[model samples]
Target: MAKVGGVVAAGFLGLSGLIWFVNLPYPMIRRPVAGIAPMLLLPSYLSMDRNYREAIAHVEQADQLVNQATSAADIGLGAEKVKLAQENLDQLPVWFLGYEPVRMCHFMGCSWNFTFDEFSRARAQVGRMNARIFQENNALTQLQTAETDLQKAKQAYQTATNVSQQQNAIADWQTALDQLTVLPRETLAGTTGATKYRNYERDFNRVVGSVAGSNQTQTMIAAAQQFAALATQNSQKSAYTVTEWQQIETLWSNAIDRLQKVDSTDPDYLAAQSYLADYTQKLGVVKTRLETEEKSTLAIAEAKRQTQELISSLPSKPNPDERNRLISRLQGIIDQLKQVQPNTTVYAEAQTLLKQAQSKLSQL
Candidate 1:
């Protein structure tokens, strides 16, 4: 029983020693492992030192090839180097030493090629955007300038027309005055005769003599007629003479009222006021006509606003016709851009966009 007990005790001690040995922390030689499971393969790798040195040499050669390919400007030559280096990496043993740099070089070369192409595409897009903005800005400027010039020209044309009308009115007044002067005083005073008829004739002669040409001669003629009519009524010594006097006073009041609205500082305003005053004296009609003509006045204002809007919408830098043509071309380019496919190499789409933009600019 004692010998059996001794054998059992030794067996238990041997089992504990085997377990401790299997779980021991051991350092790896080439492919280092943190735990015991991989430590058993350490010796085999250490014994393959000759194969390991050859793998290191291949890795170093691949590194040199990657550097050469990166520096080369010739696309074909650089691509060839990258291919060669990749072939070397593929041929290397799975467990070769210094394997990571070889793998990294392969991926980096592929990635560098992709990034270069992408950058080129992005830069091309930026150029296209700049060009489009420039064309639109230039066109807008031209349209605005042209519109302003047109407005000034229209104003000048109207002013010239008004001046011509005033001259014509003055000529008509001179003709009226000549006819009145030849008429007998009794013929002008039909209903009643006045000794003051000669005084009205004298006043007309005085105004006609002071005239700086015949510009306001028509107005003076009308005023003379009103004065002569009043004299005829006064010959009867009737109250109707007061009414004729009031009518002549009202005509003068309307002329002065319109003249007061004119801004003397503005050249055009001065011309307009002068024209209004001349018409008032010649016709004595606007006081009754102005209220009825308000609608036409509003229409003119609306027309002016519409003209301004038309000019605003027109391109500024280019002529209107040219801008319309450019806009159509720009639309075509935008359609082309949409149809263009994203490229894997150079900026093919961006290049096409740039070409279209340049073509449109040439047309402009």
Candidate 2:
């Protein structure tokens, strides 16, 4: 009976040892075994300690890389380091072990305690790094897009043949510059964008000046000025005939039309606008003059016709009622003649007719 009990005990001890040996690599599985034979888990504890140390090292290196990063490539490398650190932290079996393996093996002169705090901190760092990477990458994309637009705008401006094309190119160039101005200054791409913006702004102004100095813009301005001068010279005359006033009105109108055609993109556009306003006012004046001349000429003719009709209709020696009617008609003709304004072609004729009507009224 004693010998059978000894054999069974030997078999049980051998099976337990085999289980401990096979489960040494897995902390969760070997944790219970450690309670029965703590000495058997020394190798597993040392391995866990190494992983923890490696994870901490990775975290430090990642932090350093990220802090010093100046470009997207540097940030990418930092991201890889962060990933490696996370992988190392994941391998650490902190769930089953309450203390670091280094702490468990205190005789090895290591005193670190295992806690999820460091793991959590690492994870937080990863989140921050990822956010930074996203920001930098997005800024890089913006920088690239802005640069491409700037190049295209330059090309367009250099090759443009017309004012419209040059204006469009300048507009595009301004849009590109606007894009660069909005980038975050902390990013590598943003810094580069800023440097480019200063140079591009100067170029943009130069291009605008070039477009303004183009032959088409200058020619248009000259033509507008010529028309304005002609209109000014012609409008200086007073008391113009209806036909003459109409021609003066046309001259002012032509000047205004030419000024209106000057493109806003031209540097001379503001001057053109000033000329346009002046010309438009002159046009209104000339048009008023033309209208007055036509009206005055018709009024004088009408007054003369009425005077002749009154003379013909007079009853040789008019009765008191007929004389009063004739006098009233003459007074009305005089009043109408008085309304013919100065500066009209009919003013002189209207004055002569007014005197005749007044004399006829007095005679009646």
Candidate 3:
């Protein structure tokens, strides 16, 4: 009887050791998956010691009100708070919140393939092209860098697909999980690579002629506007020095270019045309200013000559009314001259001439 009792105790100890071994690593592995677990699983674990330790903390503060409640009405109020928390939990989609752990693991592995495998090969390919930009921008090697980034973007798209798929698997674990995982991605679709990478690809395709022929005209117009801005800045022409005027022309040209790319009925094209008219009006103002400057210069010259001749023809005392009228006319000319921008050759020359006229007037 003593030996049998000893054997029974030994068997119990061995079983307990096995259970401990299995239970210890389970939580560690499950720790990562805890957030992804479904609402249905919450009730089952609520009775467990480990569950209370891991998750109850998020809702712990609400427990005091629940515990202190003395009536059904108070309990109902406490339950309402718990329901609100559950609703908040639902707001985080299963794809984003539940399956995120599995998705993260999958993405980390996929990222490594692009960085070491695909990117290195793409860089080698661009290296063979002998791209001029590589030399000019000292980024000859950077062509490979861009290709590497492009390849990585493609890989990220693939990883997004896998992450999405893993979320579906997690959802299949429970019906509620399925609803949480599936609904949000269906509503708002997005690809893997960063948004900036997508935009870069769009602008690059337009610039490099990868886009269809229909878009070519718009692309050319955009390029032309860029060139026009460069010309306006560096051109020796005085009227062109007005950067704002050049910008107006650039806007008009860009709008026309963009307009040509789309059907005339397209709203974007119509919007471009509207912007074109606005910039065109601005350019017209610049042209009008230029013309006004030209006319004002001639009027100033004529007024100076007439005043000098009149002064010479007069006796030592000029006619008081005529002298005053000439002075007033001279002052009007100066005011108009002041309105002209000094960047123009006509305005600069006129300013020098006006100073001389003022000196002569002072003598009178």
Candidate 3 lDDT, 1-364, residue by residue in tens: 9999999999999967654443332444334434554232332232232332322332343344354543334444545554543443333222222232334435433212122333334334323222311222232133334445444544443355575653332222222111221121111111112333346545434433322223433444454456446534544455443444555455545444444444464434555465456546655665665455566556556656665665566556659887887677666655655555555546666687668767766865
Model 1: per-residue lDDT, tens digit, 92-190?
334433422234335433212123343344334334433433433343344334334434433443355575663443344344333333233322121
TM-score of 2: 0.48
The TM-score between candidate 3 and the true structure equals 0.28
**Which residue pairs come into collision in candidate 3?**
134-139, 134-140
Report how far off residue 33 is in candidate 2 (Å).
Answer: 2.9
| Of candidates 3 and 1, the better by TM-score | 3
RMSD of each: 38.7, 30.2, 28.3
Estimate the overall C-alpha local distance difference test score of candidate 2.
0.75
- Please report the TM-score between candidate 1 and the true structure: 0.16
Instruction: List, residue by residue over 276-342, the lDDT tens digit for candidate 2.
Output: 8887887888888888888888888777787788778878877889878877888878978987889
Q: Which ten contiguous residues of candidate 3 have the minimum total lDDT?
A: 184-193
Candidate 1: C-alpha lDDT: 0.41
Q: Estimate each model's TM-score.
A: 0.16, 0.48, 0.28
Off by over 4 Å in 1: 1-114, 161-364
The number of clashing residue pairs in model 3 is: 2
Error of 1 at 57 (Å): 46
Q: What do the candidate models score in CA lDDT, each in turn? A: 0.41, 0.75, 0.44
Q: After superposition, how far is residue 362 of candidate 1 from its true place, in Å?
A: 49
RMSD from true fold, candidate 3: 28.3
CA shift at 291, candidate 2, in angstroms?
65
